[model samples]
Target: MDTNHNKSEKSFKIPGDWKEQSKQLKEKFSTLTDHDLKFEAGKEKEMLERIGNRLRKNREEVLNIIKEINLS
Candidate 1:
């Protein structure tokens, strides 16, 4: 007789105060939209890249926060 088993475990717990993080993200999006409206047509590419960088940083911040809270 032979027996074998494979198992994997993953964490699926929801982080604390996710609603506040969602609200802050929405506010940041609104602010980015407002900031984008001030740029000239000729600078669209540069402005977009800047905004994208800011958003990427914001996303990373949120992810880090979630990880800290959930993994602790």
Candidate 2:
């Protein structure tokens, strides 16, 4: 219902999958810089926030895009 809440939900389901998620992100958003893709341990929110800002999208939208990235 809310932006922050959506971000929370998206991240909640994948707490330990950041690296895999980041890899999937690279396949989809090729333009993302190394810094943009870096998911430092314990900094997932910062990672998502940076990505959301770069794409000019809300957290939910960012989450939605990445959610479609099937891990391989």
Candidate 3:
């Protein structure tokens, strides 16, 4: 089994309600700037990388943060 596969399996796409989720995330993590949260459809990995670098988090952690505020 490839551990890399496990990492990819844990990755997630931004939800359809991402605008709302983005608002919540900004409110929750004040350090996150607009640039850090910039997202484009089919480019979630890059967006997550930006967010992770700014927030000092890994991809999975960023996904978890989004999940926590994903309710719409």
Candidate 4:
């Protein structure tokens, strides 16, 4: 039932403290605007997809970068 797309749509739990995370992302990639990183309820995947497209990266790579943001 298109589980992969569904999965990608549901993946990535946006951080509660997203501003700091967004800041980190901006530092790493200056092209991202607040609108790109804006975390809306149930729209985490949309944001990720937009980021991946903007960065010319795949969702998995974008996901990895997002995951790494919290590590530092």
Sliding window of 10 residues with minimal summed lDDT for model 2: 7-16
lDDT of 2 at 23: 74
In order, the Cα lDDT scores of the candidates are 0.46, 0.70, 0.80, 0.82
> What tens digits encode model 3's per-residue C-alpha lDDT throughout 1-72?
556764645446777677777888899999988888887777778888899998999878988788778753
Q: What lDDT tens digits, residue by residue, belong to model 1 across residues 1-72?
A: 434321231222334554454444446466455453234445544544455565665433534544554454
Q: Name the lDDT value of residue 31 in candidate 2.
A: 69
| lDDT of candidate 2 over 1-72, digit per residue (tens) | 555645545343453466787776777777676798786766777877888888788778877777666434
Compose the digit string of candidate 4's lDDT tens values, residues 1-72.
Answer: 555656534457875478898899999999988888888888777888888888889888988897899888
- Give the winner by TM-score: 4
TM-score of each: 0.30, 0.61, 0.77, 0.80
The number of clashing residue pairs in model 3 is: 0
- When sorted by lDDT, best at the front, the candidate numbers are 4, 3, 2, 1
Q: How far off is residue 35 in model 1, in Å?
A: 4.3
lDDT (Cα) of model 2: 0.70
Worst 10 residues of 1 by lDDT: 4-13
Sequence-dependent TM-score of model 2: 0.61
Error of 2 at 37 (Å): 1.1
